[model samples]
Target: MSWTHTFTNLCDWYTHLLHNSPTGTIHIHILRNTITSNPDNVEHILKTRFDNYPKGKPFSTILDDRLGKGIFNVDGDYWKFQRKMASLELGSVVIRSYAFETVMDEIQTRLIPVMASKAHGENGTEIKTVLDLQDILRRFSFDINCKLSFGLDPGCLLPSLPVSNLADAFDLTSKLSAERAMNVSPMIWKMKRFFNVGSEKKLREAVNVVSNSANEIIKQRREMGFATRKDLLSRFMGLINNDDIYLRDIVISFLLAGRDTIAAGLTGFFSLLSKNPRVEEMIRKELNQVLGPDQESPTFDQLRQMHYLNATVHESLRLFPPVQFDSKHAEEDDVLPDGTIVKKGSRVTYHPYAMGRMKKIWGPDCLEFNPERWLKDGLFVQQDPFKYPVFQAGPRVCLGKDLALMNMKSVVAALVPRFDIRVVEPHHEPQFVPGLTTTFRGGLPVKVIEKKMLST
Candidate 1:
């Protein structure tokens, strides 16, 4: 199989192993995990019998120190309460509008201008060389999330592209925490944490930086008064009466969710688009058709109406889900719909990363990045959640699905028509780094060509 040679691509390696398994499942005894790519098993774990598989204590303990009771790291009553409140806030039309406007403003004021400068080059020279597109997108995402989550502009995405300590700390902490999860035995990591040595000590220091930075944001909000602010942090502060730590966790959760996921999506999308210029051309053609004259960017409603762009984004996510795999522990011994036996207290993981490449689930050409798979009769058709649980499924589906899509679509709408991004190594498949979200190993280096639009 082609995936046999893709050892560097961890997801493809998993897909290769899963393909060989008769039940579309495998047990990595060393890691103490029962990983499955079967959609039936996924539906069973995520929806059909979700109660039996809350992110149990064992699963929560790994991320507990960093996430600290955030919405993504809690269970039972805590998860329910946070989910309810987050749903109310994220689902509100006003908040959605606020998020979209913030995204558009960031792209217009920061992202596009940066690309334009890069294309024009310094000293009147049209320099054609590699720029770390990944870094720029990450900065852009960080800035947008900071604005939406804390009402603070980190200025990380400015023309100078300054750095933020909180962002660097979060990156290190996420990398260390994910490393903890991949450990064959928890005892080693636990012992390190207890002794405060090695990676664990580094993790602790990074987390402290994050905590202290969060405190500053909260203090700033309180001092300035959150009465009329529309950001998530302000809204959360005004709505909840929790202690400062809990409030901090809530907003940090939003920042974590909003930042990396969008960057990952856009990164992977542009990477593929560079490899497939035909796809990029089709997208620009769709934009020309869907957007009217004098419209430099599509409005929220018009963005939603762009089926081709929607399908393209969905296709990118299928191939490169930000959170590639997720696990829920069994509270009691149970049998999955696919007849996979689950032992009490065992970690059962559903691998969206593998699922996307499964021949049975998505057909023989699953390895190909084809957006047409999502289209039907000239419009994009939604897939079943279990089959594509990239945003998760059932009760815990991502609250920011629409908002994330809007952010991505807005970036595409604003940039695709003006900039042509060419990946430095279009054919080289990137080995993903181990983190809470998908990130390329060496970052996506690219050459940006500014497109000239005819004056209307």
Candidate 2:
């Protein structure tokens, strides 16, 4: 059976149980507990009663083992400290410029070359089984993020697709995260820890690999200093004396946050663009119109000016949100509008993926891939962050929103004009691969026809 089938069956069962349960949260047979997919309830739980919910032990323990005490696993002051540090570094103009240029460099220098070779060698035939566009994209993102976060590029996008010791660490780490997310037996979890099980051993090794790499990068940055570049690594290195654990937390935090989320977003965007030629054409037209005929790398202003492209991105995100579901634990007892009381220690889930499908919030045509909903009267209308929930909402919204947009726009701007993409298999259907982020299950295979340049 397909992966989507398994997920759907699981969702169906979970939805049914949550639908009948009196409380907003229900302990699942697989996962420890799940919070129902209610918009208002999600808002209240995540925003209004935000203080009540922390990341929680069940969620924390598994990820903590691999990620260490990073922001994703930690709550309260540690999360706040890490979040502040990341924002200060990531939110800067110089850092943003570096991020945009670095990603473009990868696309032009690394990514497009791979596709170009494939297209040329295939003799115009469809490049069947891109295998894992998500993986390739992951490599690209990881490489760029390394440059941004560590001031050193790991070069994961090399010609041979060399094994990334760091990427491999992330692989094992995320696998354990998924296993733990399903709420494995605590007794088993403890016993595994006690006995030093294979999985646990693997988890520790992965964490050590990541930590050692991060520490080396930290050490390197301190020695060299940020005399010229104003990258994130420089910023962290400047404040290394603030607290060693805090510095470690920030590196791992950005590492986890940057790697998969943007790749997932781009994977969905490219998959949809392949199937929907009109969307691709519109995006290209907008890029040309806003960026001029030369097809230059988009500036921050030009990136913002390509409103339709942004909408296309938003629409894609609506359908395939990277973090499909976000979980939080209620700190104090609360009552949801559905009359489902959430106990103080109960878990809550907000399904942005499911919310995009809900006819009530997203209107009647929720499932349709229409960027027009995000555009109003021929102009792109920025929707409330709450309604979209793609980058998330409220205080904990994604810090890398601007950076993600800038990088995505850069790639699309670079490639779309030069190539016409055709989805090779199962046109119009999105295959779901559930990981830390949702990606196309079999990889998005598309035939690329080098676009004929018009004589001006």
Candidates' C-alpha lDDT: 0.88, 0.72
* lDDT at 9, model 1: 72
Per-candidate TM vs. native? 0.95, 0.89
- Number of the top candidate by TM-score? 1
Give the least accurate 10-residue stretch of model 2, judged by summed lDDT.
120-129
Task: Write candidate 1's Cα lDDT for 1-456 as tens digits.
Answer: 365464887677788889888899998776667999998899888888989989888767998878888999989887998898999999998788888889888988999888887774223355556789889999999999999998888898889887789889988988999999767788989999999999999999999999999898888878888888889988888777658899888888889999999999999888888888788888989999888667798989999889999999999999889889998889899987767778888889999989998889999999888999999998999999998999999999999999999999899888887888888888786989988899999999988777784346
Clashing residue pairs for model 1: none
Candidate 2 wrongly placed segments (more than 4 Å)? 1-34, 120-131, 427-434, 453-456
Evaluate candidate 2 by giving its C-alpha RMSD to the native, one decimal: 3.4
Roughly what TM-score does model 2 have, to 2 decimal places? 0.89
Q: What is the lDDT of candidate 2?
A: 0.72
Best model number under lDDT:
1
